[model samples]
Structure formats: C-alpha cells, structure tokens
Target: MTETLAETTPHSDEPIPAYPMPRASGCPFDPPPAAQALHDELPVAKVRMWDGSTPWLVTRYGDGRALLADPRVSSQSTLPGFPHPNAGFRENAERRRSFIAMDDPEHARIRRMVTAPFAIKRVEALRPSIQKITDELIDGMLAGPNSADLVSALALPLPSLVICTLLGVPYEDHEFFQEKSSLMINRYSSAEDMIGASDALTDYLDELIGVKLAEPADDMLSELATRVGSGELTRREAASMGVLLLIAGHETTANMIALGTVALLENPDQLAVLRETDDPKVVAKAVEELLRYLTIVHNGRGRVALEDIEVGDATIRAGDGIIIYTGTGNRDPELFPEPDRLDIGRDARRHMAFGFGVHQCLGQPLARVELQVVYGTLYRRIPTLRLATGAGQLPYKHDGLVYGVYELPVTWDA
Candidate 1:
C-alpha cells in the first residue's frame, strides 16, 4: 500500500492512545458509554475506525474547536488515498452531489449563492410565515383528541414545510424527500440502502432544478436556478447547492424541533422561563445551549489533513483522516463547567455544534428563527404540554450521524 500520512506513523514516544469509538449501533441521544470511556482515557486518542482506518479523535472542547477552525485540516473527501467511508458503495458518486463534499473555491463560490438568502435579514423577513406555520401546527395539535406525537404533529412538519416552501419543492412530495433523507442518515440501513437513498435524493433535486429553470418562482431555488441559467453557476454546482439547502434546511431543524421539545418537556422549569421570557436574545442563547447539550453529530466531524499541522498536543501530518468528536468536545468538563448538565442559562456561544470557520452551517440564521418560533410559541400555547410516554419509551434514531429522537409524544390538558 502507498505510505499513509507521516502523522499516522508517529514515533513510539509520541504514543497514540487507544480509545473506544462510537459504533453504528447504540442509542444516539444518551452519550454512548464507549465515548465517555474514550474521553476519560484519552482526550485525544487514535481510534480504529469501522472501515479499518486509524484516525485521531479529538475529544477536548478547546482541541476540537481549534482543529475545526484550522484551515490545514481539509473537509474535502476527494483527496488522494483519502478513504471516504462510503467509497465502495455504488451510490457514493451520486451522494457527493452536494457542496459539503467539495473543497475551497468550489465550495466557497457555491455557498455564496445562498448566503444572502439565508442571511439574518432575509431569514427575519420569513418570521411571519414561520409563525404562521408554527401556529398552524400547534392548532392542529390542539384539535387532536388529547395526546400528540410532537415529532409528527409539529416538530417534523414545521421545518419540512418551511424548507420545502423556501426551496420551491412541492409540499406534496415532502414525505418522499423525508424518507430519502432519513435513509441517508439512518444507521440500520444497508450499504445498498444508503447508496440508493443518496442517488434518489440527487436525482430528485436534479428534477427540481430543471423545473425551477423553466418556471421561476419567488423562492431560493428559483433564485439559484436563475443564477445557474445565467451561467453564474454550473449545473453540477447548482445541483449541489440545491441538495445542501433542501436536506440541511429541513433535517437539522427537524431534529432541533423534536430534540428541543424533549428538552423543554424534560425541564419544565426551563420551559416555563422560555415561554414567559419575551427576549429573543435570551431565547437565542438558550437555543445554543440546547444544541451543545444535544450534540446531535455524535460521530464527530469527518475531515482529512491537507498539510502538516499540529492540533493540541499532537502533530497531524498530511493525508491522515481526523474525526473531531463534537459530542465529546461539547461535553468536555474543561470548557463547560459541569458539562453534562443542561443549563440553558449557561453561556454556550462558543460551542462548535454548528461547526467553525468556512464550512459552518449556512442555514444557522433560518434555523435559529425556526427554533425561536417553535419553542417560543409552543410552550406558551400549551403551558402544560408534557410527554405522553415514559422518557425511556421515546423512539430515538441511533445509527445516523445526527443522534435524534424519532417521535416525541407530548400532551397538554385540553
């Protein structure tokens, strides 16, 4: 085999401590006992990946955040000898149809197209619509007999509707997109299942782009299609951008809606404060804290070193893959005093959940707005909303990169 990166072959004195890595199985919401084992044993350790590759897993908050911001560690997966986890799958080619799979210049140019649309100003303009969606969902929830699966009644659909409307994707096909997106992240799905979902999502987006080209609408997708047709963006670039917006625009927010609702249900006192507090700033800060507490990306970030670099105590040389375990970092006791506790009041603005630097989530503002609207309105509307089932019985998606609940059954006195 061609030599791996120099970093992979460190000297004996520079020991690469062995740590337990998260497997594709196990509960996602509650931290895997294995991750805590690794965190306690070696804050920074060499983990043997499922794919039989060795990569440094950074566990400390400071180390993970610093590495995320470091330009030397490239997020691009197309590098030489770079082992993409999905490489052998027939569907990997189609799955790479998003901007997340590209490097700079290409990533930068494409990301810029939707930046303005997702900007705080643009997102703020959608508040009225978001509020309507939230209220409508809540209204429907109220009309239900007594109990409701918040995930289905409100959390899931709110963001899906908002994202679909924003992207000009047909709302009728929302379930189709959701299923494909779920399969893309689902842990239990086979390799063929994953590849198929990836391909299907790409083809669906391609068709959407084609429709957007012939008849533009007052939506982000239409705007992007105009740019692409005008020659500002290549067809491939346009497809990637659309896929990013469509998938991310809903999936992350959908989880936040479900997970955030669970957080409020579990902590009624905090939920009370959020309901009564009129301060958007405070609500925004609380959202950040909740994100940190629920480090959805339990598997850590997937990246490869572009050049020789030093992260924390160790030196990482070119080509060595790195997975910065955000879940571990977010809970590092050093960064977060009493890190495991859910303190919405805690100042967690520095958390790397949305990641750091260039590749930071582009839809953060829209997400924030969607979250604020959902949480701010839901509790106040049903001050007594409580989980209908025992917390243990709640369905959680364990296999995917994002560890989130499936259905959050909640009820309020009618």
Candidate 2:
C-alpha cells in the first residue's frame, strides 16, 4: 500500500519550514542558509509551499538525482500535486505546454525536432564564430568607457546574438523579447503579467514562423516551419517550441555569464586559475566547476510524485509534491568535499546545475561552448579585469527564475 502524506511526516510536532528560504545578505553565491541546514539535518523532509501545501523537499545530492531520474516522479506541472515555484507559475502551468514540463514519447518527439542544432558536434563547430562574437563584444567594451556594466556589455548580448542568429530572429528586437522573457520568468509576476508575456512571445514567434515558412532560412525556426507545413506539428506546437528555445536559449546563459563573472571576481584566486590556464581541457573543467558553484537555476526543480517512492528515509506518496533543491544538492558534502569552496580543479561534472534525467537542459552543449569562449577569451585579452564596485553592493536577481546579477559593473586597465 502507498504511504499517504501524513504517514511520511517524520516529525508531526515540528512546524514545516516555508519553502524557498532567502539567502543571507552578504553570501550571494551561497545557497540559502536555511536550505543548507535542512539538507544537513534532514536530506529529505516536508516543507510548506505558498499555497499551504506541504511537499517533500529533497536536498541531498544522491536523493535529488534518484528522484529526478525516477519515472514515478513527473515534471508535468499541470498535475494536481505538482509544486509550482510561485503563484504565477501555478496559474499559467496548464496553458503553457513547453516540453520541459512533459514526459517521454511526446517530449522526445518534440525535442528531437530541435536537437540537431544543439548537438555537441554542431555547437563545437560554432566555436570559431562564438570566439569571434566574444572578441567583437569585448572589443566594443574596451572601446567604450573603462567602466561598463558587464551584464549589458557582454553577458546579455553575446548569448542574445547567438540565439537570434540560430533562430533567424532579428537581434534588433532583443529589447522587446528580453523584456517579455524576463517578466515570464520573474517569480513575483502576477498571473496576468505572466500570461501577457507568454501571449506576446507566442504571437511574435507565430509571425516569425510565418516569415520562415514563406522565405525559408537556414535556421531552427525554418526547420520548425517546415515541420508545421508538413503537418508534423501544429502551428501552436511549433510556436511553443520556438518560444521555449528563444527564452531558454538566451536567458539562462545570459544569467550564467553574469553570475559566473561575479563569482570569479569575488574569488580572484579562482579567476587566476582560469587566466593562467591555456589548455582547452582545463578551461572546460573550470566551466563545469563554475556551473556547479553557481547553479543559475537557484530555485528548486519542481515535480509531482506519480506513485509511492521511498527516497532517503522518507516515503513520497502518490500525488505528493517534490521540490529538488539543486543548489543545496550541488553543495552536499557527500558529493563534493569542501562543498562550499570554489575549486576550479575539482571533478565537478556530476553537478545537477543543468538538471538531470530526460528533461535535462537541451541547450547545455551550446551553453558550455559559449561560456568556454567567453571565460577563455575575456580574461586573456584583458588580464586586469576586475569588478568596478564591491561585491556586496552588486544587485542580484533574487526575484527571477535564474539567479544572476542585474548589473555587473566591471573594469579593466587600459
């Protein structure tokens, strides 16, 4: 017999701590103190969410990986017991049918259509182009005032240009799409705001798809348009895929670039590790370590248990919600020794920063290549790169889905 929620509770007397506990003021890169404490005390325990529903919070590295890969755990947000990150997400869950929220067969089918462009080999082939883009952006930054917001100067534009080129979307309209995408991912956004952003993006993508169909281009959007024309996918489905790629392709990477830079700046020693290394293998490992240290998707991975599952001394009942605190998992002592330290030399490939299981991030190869180019080239070209302001004063995106700085003020000696 499947255990119920009540039966799974370890401590009936203790009040469940609220989910998404805040990070301490000065510790921007660290996971929330409360979350780390919870993981240390109880790797898997129930935590109350915004809607007054208490869901199982998995914080251990091993348990998080186990639950995420388990078919019994579903990513379908529309499911009755799915733990949404916030109110806006709950409201728009059913209406927005992105493949990230889907299960196999359907998810596989849709993902296959767009996977070719992001395959490791394909992304590797774009290294020279990525390097060129990185160089040009750094050149523009160097040409301008000595002090510039890295967020605008290089972090945001590099990925934006790359994705725009891949999708055949105009880079000139970045301001509009970036605004809508930001609103869509904002944890504090209202239901109406979220839906409006989705509608606007969907409409924009629909128009773009129409253009692609009439005048096919050598891009992912054109490929999606072809599928739509062949009746392999409905127009809405194609648009949904486009919107997913367009938003995810840039937003997550943009945030990673900024956040990783902040992390490197704060730890000049770690930055030196990258600056001194000329080996591609070393640079790639450092990127993985950075990805582990600063898991941009700080908000836990949301899911619903479809069946009774025993995970790390707790029984997750059928229909019970589960939130995998990946940031905490990345810091789990069992997984990485000196979990809090930012060590570029550590074997950090096992980190769940890009998630795991079938829903693992599709654009990871592209993201890795982009970061490899940026981190490798930026410091080499400008050896004196340093933050223009103190790390404590930097503005962080605590209210958004991805964790990053709002502005990374940086400078390098001429």
* C-alpha local distance difference test of each model: 0.76, 0.90
Whole-model lDDT for model 1 versus the true structure?
0.76
Kindly give the stretch of ten consecutive residues in candidate 2 with the minimal lDDT sum: 1-10
Model 2: residues with Cα > 4 Å off, grouped in runs = 1-9
Error of 2 at 63 (Å): 0.7
RMSD per prediction, one decimal? 4.2, 2.8
Q: Residue 252: error of model 1 in Å?
A: 1.0
Please report the candidate that would top TM-score against the real structure.
2
Candidate 1 clashes between residue pairs 3 or more apart in a chain or in different chains: none
Per-residue lDDT of 12-86 in model 1, one digit per residue for the tens?
345443333443343334466666766676566676654567777777777777787787878776664343444
